[model samples]
Target: MLHDAMWDDEFPHDPTICYLNHAAVAPWPKRAADAVSAFARENIHQGARDYPRWIQLEHRLRGQLQSLLNAPGKGDIALVKNTSEALSLVAMGLDWTEGDEVLISDQEFPSNRIPWQALEGRGVTVRQVNLDASDPEAALIAAMGPATRLLSISSVQYASGLRMDLERLGRACRERNILFCVDAIQSLGALPFDVQAIDCDFAMADGHKWLLGPEGLGVFYCRREARDRLKLTQFGWHMVEAMGDYDREDWTPASTARRFEPGSPNTLAQHALSASLELLLEVGIQRIQEALQQRTAYLLQSISSIPGARILSPSAPERRAGIVTFTISGCPNAWLFQQLKDGGIVCAERGGGIRWSPHFYTSQQVLDNALAILRNALQHYNRSR
Candidate 1:
């Protein structure tokens, strides 16, 4: 396992800021920035002269993503503009009957919820299941009726950090012949995700959050057997089998997940993402998960020790990921958020509370500094009250 010191050079964040916002936009590592810089310089010196090498990097990125998700093959992966685009492809591509139902959690990010809800125009009903029950997975499975065609859910709840029992849900979906789609934006780089182990038909995640890459590129994994189920919703030269044969009058979409990419590739973003994935792969996902859990555990324990802190996120080690959200009694969330922002403690205001998300590389000093700021702010608020 790599220690914090070993990875210090990779992340040289501003010393003054306590960055706990990996759940939102993450700061790219030094290697990723260097990759982008080098690419930019090459483009300036020789435009398209080294385009073949850039394509090779793109291929390598697909292989890295294949390893990250543990998909059956590299061909199962599609590099989309972002998670929303990928979800849109799945949502718009699938044929929906009048009575078909799509099951999802009530706590999903808008990206996960809106796509299925959009299908309502096609006579498809979107059912949102509350995940506050003792057995969230069981509740979701029970809600599935004969009309249920798909179960679209996030691997981890964005606001509450409630990690789902994907294996259990996937098994139930398989038994019921229901399609399973995972919006993994919050959990992909923070945790170890396996599409094969979960048996999900489709999964998507953006690179900006935990992947430590640029904003425009994300990944979509479509199971080989389930690929043909979704009718093609977009088309262009890049998505065709004979992509380089522009002169060919006849063409067919690529049999692989590449069929979803309708336009030209984002090669610049691809270079940066490929470099970021290299760092994650080098450290190993299992190690990253361990480090991230340690950080969350510390935050949970420390926040609970505060006089009025009420943690909104799950307390159980197995039921959480990198997010820790909480609210202080008698303190307005907006006020508290502003205080943290002023104190250089980077976080997000979410789920009616303040959310602090720390990555594996987040140092003890940053955590302590953020906590100190919170304590001082609470004391000041108490005095004013």
Candidate 2:
């Protein structure tokens, strides 16, 4: 279990600002910033003196991702730019036939939708399942036709914060012999994820959201058996075996998942993310999960108490992770968002409501103050209307 003192040290002492937007770019952990700072100082003082140490750190990050995702092997994980790029690898790599169908949710983030849609030129079809149904899983399963070759979905809906039952979906996909892909950007760090249990073929997530790291670097998990089936679309020296041997003209793509890696690594982002992953590992996933649940419960209790406010997210605990979205009756979402912004409340506008996302380390006082400001803004909006 995580001690309160351990999590409390993460929030820098900002007197007036309330930051509850971990579903977006999280405020980096203290250790992460310190790691970057130390790296900068090392570069300023001595150039490339510790290059070998940096390579070791990158390897460590890969190992951490292996443990975090419970991948079949470390070779299944590829360090990529973001979820979009990883998903594109599968989209373009797959041998698609005309009339082949891909199943996805109507509410999928653009990343999941656009890549499959890009295949329209090849005469591939994209089937969208409605999640508003009582049984979302059943709806998605029913939409799979004989022509359906793959299913891609976000583990959690970005705006509504609705978590899907990945295990159940994975089972259904296996039964149908369809390829399973998950865009886990929203739930990767906020909730516990085990790819082996889910039996997914491909899974990817960006490090920025929920992972508390910099943008432009993400983790992509490809099942070892599935790695050989997909043809490589992008090629570079890094993607080849015996990559450093420029003298050898005879080379082949790596037999491992590293074949997806196109170019040189992002060493800077690696240090920062390495530090962030270290914090999560130290806290442990179960403890971090508990903190998020407690904070979200408290937020729901306080937000529901205010007048003219209605919760837009799922009310049941099983249906949610760490996001709580609400809408005030009299205010436009844009207006309320701007008001909250001006009042130093960091949040987002999504799903026709104001979204508040807090990480495990958010203090109760920040939530209380932000809620109070929101209520005042709502009351003023009511009077003016």
Candidate 3:
């Protein structure tokens, strides 16, 4: 039997603020905070005596990340600074030729778009597929041509809350033989992800968002076969197999995904991230899946009952994850966002609307309170006209 995973017993704090923006930076679970605090205290007390233990913690983190992405091996995982660095590793590592093309969605976050756009200097072309179309998959598949070297996409769109059929896209890429890369920052910890299922060559996510950890650390997964295929654009002593041997005269990039990590690991962020993943693992991804589905459904139901509010996130359960977006008919999105912000209901403005992303730990009462605030905010907007 799956463990009884609903562990929300209330975080030890004021407990009044409603954080509905896991899509953005998430509030760390208390366990993760306590872990970081303990590690900090240890640093001040023991110095580097147990520093080897921290390295072991980092190795354990790689194992958990390997499980998270469902990669074939922990050898496929690289500890990069953040999503941008991982994206950059792929961007600069590619062997691009003049007229070679890369495909991405129109709704891509800048991290996913700008790196590919930088390839213009190599005479490569970047194509943005419109995911807002009636048939997004067809539109993306049709965008590829003989010159298409890669198809990069976000597993779940950052804004608009559009979750793509990654399996279909992966199969299409497999048939066409185009390298598939996924910017999984939005989906990795929020839902189940599998590189084998998606047939992706690479996938990456930072720890700050749904992983519920600190910034400055992230995971990058490169398939074992693709490890050497990517050109290494960055190089340093730490990425070598003889990482600690400063006297080595000859060296080579690590055959494993460590080739991408060109420096010392972020031990600080790793402890916090490992702590966060422990909670998610303890609760089980299956349970989080059901909880998020229930929360999103409840949010949609609450918003639809309001007369002038328009839900921009998908109403279909499978098409949604933790994010719910909506707009007030005549209200400026900025105004609604500010009102919600001032009201202490935390979310964001995305897809030209207000987006609310609640985690599984979020209570029904908190959401109901947020919904009440939304209704009041919208009612004021409705009246000001």
Candidate 4:
């Protein structure tokens, strides 16, 4: 277990604000910030003199991602621009027939939805299953018809904070002979995620959210057996097996997930993400999940205690991740969101309510302060009404 001092040292957020927005862009840990600063200094002074070392750091980042996903090998991982790009790779690369279909939940973020919807041009159908039922996985599985070529869903719904039973869905997909894809942005760093356990053919997530890294860099995991299912959509020197062999007349894509990356690596983001992942690995993901569950439980209980506050996110522990969304009766979401923002409570208006997504390291005092502000605002609004 990491000490309290270590948590405090890693996250030195502004003392004045209560940051409960990890579901959105998160503030980088001090180590990640320091790493980017050092990288910038190196580029300013030495300029590619340490290019080899930078590549080494990138390799380390891949290995860390492999560990994070429990991927079969580092070869199974590709560092992409973000989750949308990764999803697009799969959506466009797959060989879709006129009537082939892609299945997804209605609650998916745009990153997971638009790519498949874009496939309509290719005569591919995109079906959205409502996940508000008592058994979401069962609903999804039952919705997969014979033409369903893939099941692409988020591990946790963004607005509702509803965690899916990935393993069950994977089993269903396997039985139906349909490909499984997961948008893991909501669950990757907030909860324990295993691609192997889920048996997903493809999975993707951005570093800026739960991973505590910057924008413009993310991970794409392609299962070893399913790698060849998606045809190559992009090609470049960096993706060739004989990389740097400029004189070679014939070239083949690298026989790994690197085939998905056809451009120069984001070395700067690599260093920052690597540093952030190092902190997560050191503290351990299971511990982080436990801490986040505690925080979510606290938020759920505290928010429910406030008069007229109605929970929008799933209340059951097994059904939720880091998000706790709620609304106060008779209080407009926009106005409530502004009140919280004005009160130094950093949250989001989502799913007809305000969403509070606290990280594992978020202090109890921060949660208390945010809830207090919320309570006061609701009470004042109720009195006026």
Model 4 earns a TM-score of: 0.98
What is the TM-score ranking, best to worst? 1, 4, 2, 3
Q: Which candidate number has the best lDDT?
A: 1
Off by over 4 Å in 3: 1-6, 13-15
Judged by whole-model lDDT over C-alpha atoms, candidate 4 comes out at 0.92
Mark the 10 consecutive residues where model 3 has the least summed lDDT: 1-10
- lDDT of each model, Cα atoms only? 0.93, 0.88, 0.87, 0.92
Superposed on all Cα atoms, the candidates' RMSDs to the truth, in angstroms, are: 1.1, 1.5, 2.0, 1.3
Ranking by lDDT: 1, 4, 2, 3
- The candidate that achieves the highest TM-score relative to the unseen native structure: 1
lDDT of 3 by residue, 206-282 (tens): 99998999999999999887788789988898688877889989999888888888877788788889999998888
- Per-residue alpha-carbon lDDT of candidate 4 for residues 100-193, written as tens digits (9 for 90 to 100): 9999999989999999999999899999999989999989999999999999999999998999999999999999999999999999888999
Between candidates 1 and 4, the one scoring higher on TM-score is: 1
TM-score for each predicted model, relative to the true structure: 0.99, 0.97, 0.97, 0.98
